[model samples]
Target: MDITQTTSVATQAAASSADKSAAAISSDFETFLKMMTAQIENQDPLDPIDSADYAVQLATFSSVEQQVKTNDLLTALGTQMGGVGLTQAAQWVGMEARVAAPVKFSGDPITLSPNPVAAADEVNLIVKNSQGVEVQRQPISVSNETIEWSGVDRSGTPFVEDTYSFYIESKENGQVLATSTVEAYGQVTEARSQNGGTILVLAGGSEVDMASISAVRRVD
Candidate 1:
């Protein structure tokens, strides 16, 4: 296994074990104190408990208690570090991430990253409105290069300001081969952690997991 994976597993196991161990140690310490007190109180004055033996028992319990405290501190520190990790993820804000999410049109050209199929001889850009209606269809180059899409209709009239989805329709000899949702670069508005994974909120209020990000770049 990878070292990072092994370390993560070990850390999680240690954290879980620490909590259980702390509880058990606390119970044991209480029992030990009660037993010691009962013995001291019931002992005869002539044959009293030796001070040296009592010291040894006290020192042992003290060491065990200290160990439990140390474990508790480690657990707390782990939690703090997890929070710090999310703080670091905040740096992703303001950057552009390539994701397959709707692009919010607000009187600005949206850049789309369309990936046409290799077997496609022709490709067409299919624009869908917020209500899932096909608003426009136009031919586009069958290449992986980014395309700037103006949020307008065939007559060069701007559509209503709303979220729009783009799909790439691939065809071979006028027969539709496949249509797939295209990815677009959207600026990150926020970064947060959820369910042990990082999530990036796009400018259009769309949330995507870190794993869904295809590429990231500066908003130049």
Candidate 2:
């Protein structure tokens, strides 16, 4: 099913659950009230029940009723929020999201955003294949905001089409300082709600949390 339909069904389920809980709470409350009334009416006239005892009973029931109502309202609010999130996430489909993860390469150059350490004097791009095997390493400009990777190997040959990861290896005085993955843009093919959060599926069928997306843009 599509995202919108899936979310609607989920919301309906939550609403039904809330309705059932409210009904059960109401039934229990009515029974409590009826039993209390009967107790009061059948109390011995000479030794009538203490007014303080009745007050305590009423106060306790009132608290329980209030708590149940509060829970019902909260459940409804959560359902509403989930629907809103799914609606927003559905709009992200067909767009390109910038994230730090492996991306599938199919002959087209991929744009990468490298973040190198500030203290490093040199930075190199490290390319790894799906199996985490290093395939290419080349020096890159430190000040470049974005780089279009040609998906080529060190021997100047095009790599076989597959999922690949890119990293920025920062060095100072020939000593490695830090290595961090670079963000790349990938088309978002699907979106869904999982564990109360939105997840986006990229073109390669990889799933990423919506919160991890650094930027989005329409596919050129």
Candidate 3:
């Protein structure tokens, strides 16, 4: 099902659970009250039950009842927040999101965001296929920028269609400085709630958490 429908189902399930809990709490409260009343009515006239003990019992029941109500309110709030999250995630569909993860490359070129170390004088972009084998290496600008990969190997031949990952290595005067980070771009094809969080399904068949997206832009 779609994200909206999935969220609705989850909300309904939470509401049903809350309703049952509330009902059970109410029933138990009523039974306690009935028992307390019976005890008071059947108590000895000369040796009546201590009023202080009854007060304590009543106070405890009141606390439990209040807790149950609080739980119900919190559950409702959670459902509402889930709905809002689903709404926001839905907007990501059909958009391109920049995330720090590997992505699939079918014939289309993939965009990579390279973050180079500040002290480095040179930066290199390393492309690796799904098997973790280096396929291409190219010197890139030292500045943090987005670079496009045409899925070609070192010999200028296009790599076969598969998932690939990118890494950035920064160097200073031929000595390695630091291995920087790289971000991948993908088109969001679907959004859904999973395990109390929203997941963005990319067109490349990869799933990413909504919170993991660093940047988003509409697909032209």
Candidate 4:
């Protein structure tokens, strides 16, 4: 169904699998111990099993048990971490975040953080739509500053409210100096976990990984 529903199902399935695995391991261990006891009891009196062999078997069993316990603990820890992630995600719901990824332009002016190369004499901000088509381009200062886009095309015509990406090109005397990294500020509308990681769903349907967020601030 929806992403949130899918994530919930996945989490439940993982917890169930962990529980089943722990149960199976415990059951198998009990069977193994019983089998070993039967072997020792039915051993020949004159040709008894070597004490060294018994010790080795016991050691192996202990190792397996320890490994199973470790797995159980790790599984529990993962579940706990997932809960903590959800709690943190809930806190991000109404806050603005600067993420190192493309952003959605919803007719409102969006702020972009651009980092220009140290030696660059000129910097330009390139705006691209979801289809990777350049819609607007403008010169910017060669400094680490935030630029705002009015969601308009070159002709001053406003672009339809939708998701758009941005890129920054730094040049020095017509030669390309660097293509700097761009960060977009957006509001987090929702959050979901997929593939063992948290993803923030922003306004205008853009999604970004929680780890990709560089900064967070109140949406005043």
Cα lDDT of candidate 1 equals 0.82
Q: What C-alpha lDDT do the candidate models reach, one value each?
A: 0.82, 0.87, 0.85, 0.82
Q: Per-residue lDDT tens digits of candidate 3, residues 1-220?
A: 8766777887888888888988898899889989999999999999999999999999999998898889888987887787788889898888889987778888888888888888999888988877889887899899877878888776778889887778999999999988755898988888887777788888757788999999999867
Q: Write one digit per residue (lDDT tens) for candidate 2, span 48-143.
A: 999999899989988988898888778778877877877887898999889998888888999998989998899999999889999888999976
Q: Quick one: best lDDT, which candidate?
A: 2
Which stretches of candidate 1 lie above 4 Å from their native place?
1-21, 24-85
lDDT of 3: 0.85
Which residue pairs show collisions in model 1?
none
In model 2, which runs have C-alpha deviations exceeding 4 angstroms? 34-49
Model 3 residue 87 lDDT?
86
C-alpha-based local distance difference test score of model 4? 0.82
When superposed on Cα atoms, how far off is each prediction in RMSD? 9.6, 2.3, 2.4, 3.1
Worst 10 residues of 2 by lDDT: 75-84
Our tally of clashes for model 3 stands at: 0
- How high a TM-score does candidate 4 get? 0.86
How well is each residue in 116-197 modelled by candidate 4, as lDDT tens digits? Answer: 8888999999888878888877998888878787887767899987777888999999999877558889889998876667
Give the CA lDDT, 0 to 100, for residue 159 in model 2: 90
